[model samples]
Target: MQKTEKPFVEVNNLYKVYDGFSSVLDNVSLEIARGEIACIFGPNGCGKTTLLKIIAGIDKDYQGKVLIGGKSPIEVRTGIVPQDYDMTLLPWRNTVDNITLPLEVNGYSRRVLREIVVEFLKKMGIKLPLLSPVYKLSGGQKQLTVIARTLINKPEFLVMDEPFASLDSSHFFQIADVLKRIWNLTEVSTVLVTHDLVTAVLLSDQIFLFSPKPGRIVHCEKISLPEPRSVSDPLFVETVNYLQGVFLMGGE
Candidate 1:
């Protein structure tokens, strides 16, 4: 991203501790420009979710300067998809109802909400039953419902905390395509947390590596690759293998 342009999201000297016992973050700092898709990569139990929650303003008891769109994170409207769909989506609600919750809460009329959701589902190629309760759907379908809900408002930025962690390989590819399509279509700035190196390398414009718990960023760099990235391509193979090796070597 160009330094001349204002950052879409910025984290400076961030630190977080829970129950006043142990630190979850340590002096973390980063910047993401408007419309950029960035990913935080780290091991499990590494405070990735904590960091994301802080960034999304879901958790405020932390020491940090987090800004989104020139304002504090809590002041900004962010679309968030948490890793656990079971927790985020209401089990009693149907797919359409789930996606329209935000809209309904914000006073969108019933007709307008339906139109928005129907159009969004069509655009994303999602075919789940609109009235099917969230609990009745398969894991992949439930995740897709969460994705649709996250995007329904056309939020200026998106925060995804390991959104695909529960899915199988086939669903991972499918949702990856959906996310890419959403990014291209809406130009929404996105920040994702994941432990999957290949997925991070494949989707992100820049990848931020994190340490184990007390998760400070260990490293960050842009991934330069042409669109329609081919896994068989030499550059793709080289970058993935290099990152995979670096991560395996404990991100030293």
Candidate 2:
């Protein structure tokens, strides 16, 4: 494989504390290469969400330098899909309106926004007719709508926090495939935070393993499974097993 350029996202000496009782993230550092799908995996309460929030600019009180394309996180034009759909998507708006809200807020012309929204709806497998009234849509549809919203802006960096946690296995893989296809199509750097090991193995080019509270990155493994990897492949199973071992044996 050809070596890529420097990381599009980098976190150095990151630390987060709440109530001064304990640090959620302690001197954690990571790098995500351009066009790579990087996954952050760890036990619950391991500060994975906190780290992603800081990177997404949702939480700014932490101590660290998060750089996106060599600029501060706030300086980079990026998109974020939060773990909670309710937090990221407006309940009152219909799917299309929700997806296009970002573009409208960013001052895109109506015609331009319409064009982008149409393409993203198609990409997300959301039909135009079903775009009305988020409450009318199924859970899976709502999640896809949020993804479409994130992609509609054509961000250089995309951050997803357990976006598939609520989906059934079938829906999860379908969404995962859609995400992979979109990443290939856009070549955008992505960071996905999930507790699901299988999902991480399926979607990531690199995996970052974190330890429990007072979290710190213990391992950074470059996934070498061949492209178009099938979950049934023996090599894929072997890779997953090895990753599980790495996670079980966390080190500083």
Candidate 3:
């Protein structure tokens, strides 16, 4: 018998209700292939973060099946980067210390973990102010530190919620380029939540559009643009405009 292939990540009939009244997500289903970067784009209150929380094993009240590599989210090696970089990062910890924090949890010595962080930064081509405390870093630098900390453990599935939400245009593109570099280096399957159509077009292999509250998968767009994409490219602009039109038309 031929083997049946399964998706790397699967969400089937997902429904989330708060206090048995508020319906956040309804009958949401989607499949993500291994090593692909998928973006979740939707209006505010459409349960994008709820879905991400469910996938990250942070929220367990929802009713539905969410699987990562045919196992529950808790069973997988998952890394999560929340939108609030400032709140999540340790203000007292410097860049290397913060990046090594996860390893420290597993009883790794600080010296060893610092070596690992150094190697990881080298591999990812990332340079940070290693001695500066996270609170002293700029917004972009803080976000990059959070990302580096999450990625240091080499997670099998990565979940990022609006990673670029806090950056200005210059830092936004800088971080976006870093993300592309990370994808090239690790190819870690990622589910990123973002409100920006341009970001979705630039980073995702598949873009999942959700409806307003009681969110469902309204559309799943495949982005076939070549890697190292540029906003100046005509096709890239066209794709962003098209997605914007869809949003303006209320996902019609």
Best by the TM-score measure = 3
How many Å off is the CA of 244 in candidate 2? 0.9
lDDT: worst 10-residue window of model 3: 1-10
lDDT against true structure, model 3: 0.90
Residue 96, candidate 2: Cα error in Å is 0.5
Instruction: Give TM per candidate.
Output: 0.95, 0.93, 0.96
lDDT of 1 at 146: 90
lDDT of 2 by residue, 126-155 (tens): 554445788777667778888888888888
Q: How many residue pairs clash in each candidate at the backbone level?
A: 0, 0, 0
Root-mean-square deviation of candidate 3: 1.9
Best by lDDT, which number? 3
lDDT of 3 at 36: 89
Q: Can you tell me which runs of candidate 1 are displaced by over 4 Å?
A: 249-252
lDDT of 3 by residue, 53-168 (tens): 99998998888899999999988889999999988998887888988987877997788889999999888878899988788899999999989999999899999999999899
Candidate 3 TM-score, C-alpha based:
0.96
- Each model's lDDT comes to 0.88, 0.84, 0.90
Poorest 10 consecutive residues by lDDT, candidate 2: 122-131
